[model samples]
Target: MTDLAALRAALQLQWALGQEILALVQREHLALTEPGQRSGSAFEFFRQRLHLLPRLEEAVAALRRHRAAWQQLSPALRRSDPEIGALLRANEDLIFRILLLDRENQQLRLRHGLLTVRAESHPHSNRSTSGQFSALA
Candidate 1:
């Protein structure tokens, strides 16, 4: 017996938080691109301030409980409730996009690391042979 209005509001809040996190990721990506930029400080700050992300599993679990309760509601209630449906759909899309972005970011990081290692290991070997010493000298 969940409060439908409260459940809907919680879903909306979770969706909003996800959208805010996405915005932060975009900002971090921009900061990551500058040649002379170091994101260590920003990352540390975010690590301290964004601890909510780790606790999101709790929020997600709550949402699941609420969703289950919603599902057990009468069919007429579900059909008549557009706000709940919209909130669920938005939250689902946000979570899916977050997962997709995480995978893409990991792949990009691996590729970048490989490229850096290759570049460091294989220095330019093709030196010009214009300067020569004669054995006769």
Candidate 2:
């Protein structure tokens, strides 16, 4: 396929993956907020993401290859191609939203006792911890 064709395909895949991941995060956010839905909520979010992992990896590799193709395209072409430009714009918007949602999810996790602020985050404490504790730090 042509470089333009490949770039288009890669952008499409990236957009799809971003949407799916965003949906998963949104679901996790909703799960965290709802009352009386405690059983297996975290596990369900993990299971969906785990199932998406292979597709995500494959898309990453494809995008890496496409990155070279994108670089090969002339700046004029990049500016002129409406579909490619729109896809890139949409991808950027989706990324911004996903980040916002992920931050909200993290705060929700903290509020719901699924996460702790960690020792380092505390102003007075210099204590060392391991595993999840270290992760939070």
Candidate closest to the true structure, highest lDDT: 2
Q: What's model 1's overall lDDT?
A: 0.56
- Summed backbone clashes in each candidate are 0, 0
Best by TM-score: 2
lDDT of each: 0.56, 0.64
TM-score per candidate: 0.64, 0.65
- Model 1 misplaced stretches (Cα beyond 4 Å): 32-42, 45-50, 114-137
